[model samples]
Target: MPSPRPDVHPPVVTGIGVASGLGHGKDAFRQGLFEGRSVFALLARPGRQRGDGSPPFFGVEMPDPPSILPPRVERTAGLSGRAAVAVLDEAWREAGLDRVAPERIGLIVGGTNLMAREQFLSLRDYAERLDFLPPRHGHVFLDTDICGLCASQFPIRGFAHTIGAASASGAAAIVAAAEAVSSGRVDACIALGALQDVSALDLQGFRALGALGAGPVCRPMDRGHDGFLYGEACAALVVTRPELAGGTIYGRVLGAGFCADGCRGPEPNSDGQVRAAQDALADAGLAAADIDYVNAHATGTPSGDDAELETLRRLNLGHARVNATKSIIGHGLSAAGAVEAAAVLIQMREGLLHPVLHLETPLDEGFGWVRGGMAEHRIRHALKFSFGFGGSNIALVFGAPEGAAA
Candidate 1:
């Protein structure tokens, strides 16, 4: 089948919803980014500790979103599902998507562990007490039920898919939604995803791998970089054809490229990243020189950031303004890409970019790092990178409103 021409049917983002450690909704998240303050506190309860007997690591856990789901079904939906419902309501409301028919709308959910939290909690509780307290009911304990539950609460009636591709899951979901809309499969589609605070399973796993940071703080790409802290966040985006757009477009998903690194271990090479960036440029019919800036997937890991920085140099994107936000907002696992992409769209819309947090020493001399404070620039076109653990790499190209300030 021949590829559809975007010129004839362009896909655009009409609305956004976010609930993260920074705060709830768009304004709160943007304000937190502007301040460049870290909201991380001592783990509310407790997690694994350093072998040296330091206090357990710090993390940020987002409070439950406004209660919008029916109590009966809410009990069975899991935290991920509940978060998705709240954000989808916000995005759907803002986009005026109610006018669209339920049958024409599509829903896609993404995350590293779509049902990890629910499954873990249930089994852990049972193991703690062999004597059963109460029996579980509905789909709350099942990951496969996420898609069906979301279909019932929201107007989405078309295809419902759950994508689990590690950290790039959310971005992968967005790429799929864009293709669905661009191909005329649906008038609009919502990409929803959420990650619970780092689970004991993940904490112990990353810690055993020596991936957690020693300092309470995390500095992405810093010379003293350690590792990432798990952050809780839920985000949703509404993508629809330009003709059906109800609100001003936040940005256009002009092009997307998805690839794999084939890395057997934690650290990966830069070749796959460079390839993904190249594919995005080609898909958008653009050149490396045409791009304005990049939102890097630097999650504060030394090896990962090193490889990503090398990829930027190889692509000759050192001149482009690049910002790493993981320092301000801890990595949200599969939700990182979607949330970070939202931040990029916000920066493009505002013409101001946030500075890297606590980055005193530089890791690479080639990067045009936005440090000290926010920087203002003419950003018409930008790039968003989503590189996940286990070698998944995705690149996305975003553009501001046409005929607007460059």
Candidate 2:
């Protein structure tokens, strides 16, 4: 990686990759958007083989494993690690960073359940035969050490950070990476967030909170909306100087802001969400009117969608389009922010916005729900918003380069 050019626009995403409930890679996700494919579906009870560890995991459908991953790596690292590797391989190949120094790059990954040791324990319970047990070797790299996995895989010398803000972790990681590059400490960075969705313990835990959807499908803002459909994914992006970027430039991450409402357990404050969005606009030297699209953090939950709608409507930005990808991919927790952010980037490049899947009921005034496969829009700037369980909220603004065609 090269040193950051302070005089330049600090960092730009030259390449992007995402292994989400929707799919993997930029083209695949963009295709899913254009085709109106909803990747959200029920987890297979005993579906795929254990590509990695002992316990079976559930996530969005993925293609065959990439050749880059060693068989031993797959057998040991589990789902989150595999997902991270998938994203990094796609990004590194797409970005063509043959000349970039690995040490100049940085890693900022976020997760609430990054291959938890408890997952293996749960696996041990389910399976009659156990291959690997919790190590007594005093290894520093535990399953919860998500940052260690990322740093070891990518080998970035700049600071590596891992956040645990439930659903909003991915967005926060991206914000932090942007700040790091802006400060001239690193030339480029990779921000990722992922989780395994099929852990019985995790599911039982959410059920304990009464947060799991009673029905099979997740319906955001629907009259019959029940609760969130739990899912897993890992999304990664290559953030670098705009001038050095190659390939199809999706969008530029202009600015980001985060805040907490001091609430607990899936509660959201519309006022706080509005404030966060406003703060992001101001940080980007943009006004609400400047934003063309708003990718909502609506989790298909009644209160969550309602609160997000209120905030989005209150902003009253002139003629901004609103769409929720959760309607397509379910709620991916920490990976939700990165996945949606990557979707916004693709739509910006394709000059079309994917409609919110399964949005039947009408939102309140000023907040329109998108329908159908894809809607054409001349979007220059867009906002990707994520609000988490503990009222942690983040709003990110992305736009094309100043002189680029919208």
Q: What is the TM-score of each candidate against the true structure?
A: 0.93, 0.87
| Candidate 2, superposed: residue stretches over 4 Å from native | 1-10, 45-64, 116-123, 126-146, 196-198
CA lDDT scores, all candidates in order: 0.78, 0.70
- lDDT (10s digit) by residue, model 2, range 1-406: 1122223474677777887655667777778777778665546544232445543332344554355556755555656677777887787667765446776787777766555444545566647644544453133234445566556666566667677678998888788777776776777777776654445566556656666665456777676676777666678877776666766566677777788888887677998788788778777778888887888887777777788777876888537888878777767788888878888887877788888777776555446456766888877888889888887888888887666753
- TM-score of model 2 relative to the true fold? 0.87
lDDT of 2 at 105: 81
Q: What is the lDDT of candidate 2?
A: 0.70
Report the poorest 10 consecutive residues by lDDT, candidate 2. Answer: 1-10
RMSD (Å) of each candidate, 1 decimal: 2.6, 4.9
